[model samples]
Target: MRERPPAAELDAVDRRIVDALQGGFPVCERPYAAAAESLGIAEEELLARLQSLLDRKVLTRFGPMFQIERMGGAFVLAALAVPEADWARVNDAVNAFPEVAHNYRRESDLNTPFNMWFVLATETREGIAEAVRKIEAATGLVVHPFPKLKEYFVEMKLAVRGEALS
Candidate 1:
């Protein structure tokens, strides 16, 4: 896979676009047009720029952020100590499940046993456990689930200037 370009490569227009759309998006028939107008750019330009950003991997995803728990769903963080040689197989096996929202491989820490981590979302709390069991059965590896116990306040507004903001 190709590495994503650095944020420093983003232009002023790109920065403005990222900053303006980071917050709540407009709920209108022509949402893009409305947003583009607010950003002082043409609708077509806004769409094209967003597409380019996505294609370049500058923006990993652009969509609504849903509160699954509030909507009678459950989300959990799960991990596995996948052997280096079996990384691809395990990744594919676990990600094949629809409940697997996303997964990433992390360097194993001396203190932690698990190296691969992923988020699983399901329609119910029981579904979370079921997905974990399914993944364990499919990969022949135990899935350690870490469910959220307390809520934390997090502000996710990122003003992607010509520099890293994350």
Candidate 2:
């Protein structure tokens, strides 16, 4: 983890720069410069501010967020209960698959259970299944791969404007 910057260190310009880039600045060749101009700052200065924000853990990541399905990739939301003693091993195993985006450790009823979750993207269901199989083999645990049943509710929007959302 990177060291966080002091909150008091951030000035109005830094805050504004973070806010402007959060929701997404612009989708053009000169996105940074455009955003900088909007905030009345130089392009290099804005870039440096963004870098500071990142270094301080104010922003985990930056750049374009894609629509996976539109880009011909598949994603499924699933979780696993991993024993505490085995959590590290299981986490590594699940994440070993190329399709696995990320996994997190969460508290659960299952003793020492760390939630192993990921998205498997591929050209077809068979490919996703194959990826899951690889995870299963690596972890030596049966993954309960519960794919999206249907689009019952898919409401995703920016909760806060000018704030980047993962």
Q: Which candidate is the best by lDDT?
A: 1
Q: Model 2, which residues run further than 4 Å from truth? A: 1-11, 109-114, 123-125, 150-166
Candidate No. with top TM-score = 1
Candidate 2 TM-score over all chains jointly: 0.72
Per-residue lDDT of model 1, residues 1-166, tens digit only: 2344445467778888888898678888999999999999999999999999888887888879888998899999999998878988998998899999988767634747688899999988789988988999999999999998997999878766445343
Candidate 1: C-alpha RMSD to true structure equals: 3.3
lDDT of each: 0.85, 0.70
Least accurate stretch of 10 residues (summed lDDT) in model 1? Answer: 1-10
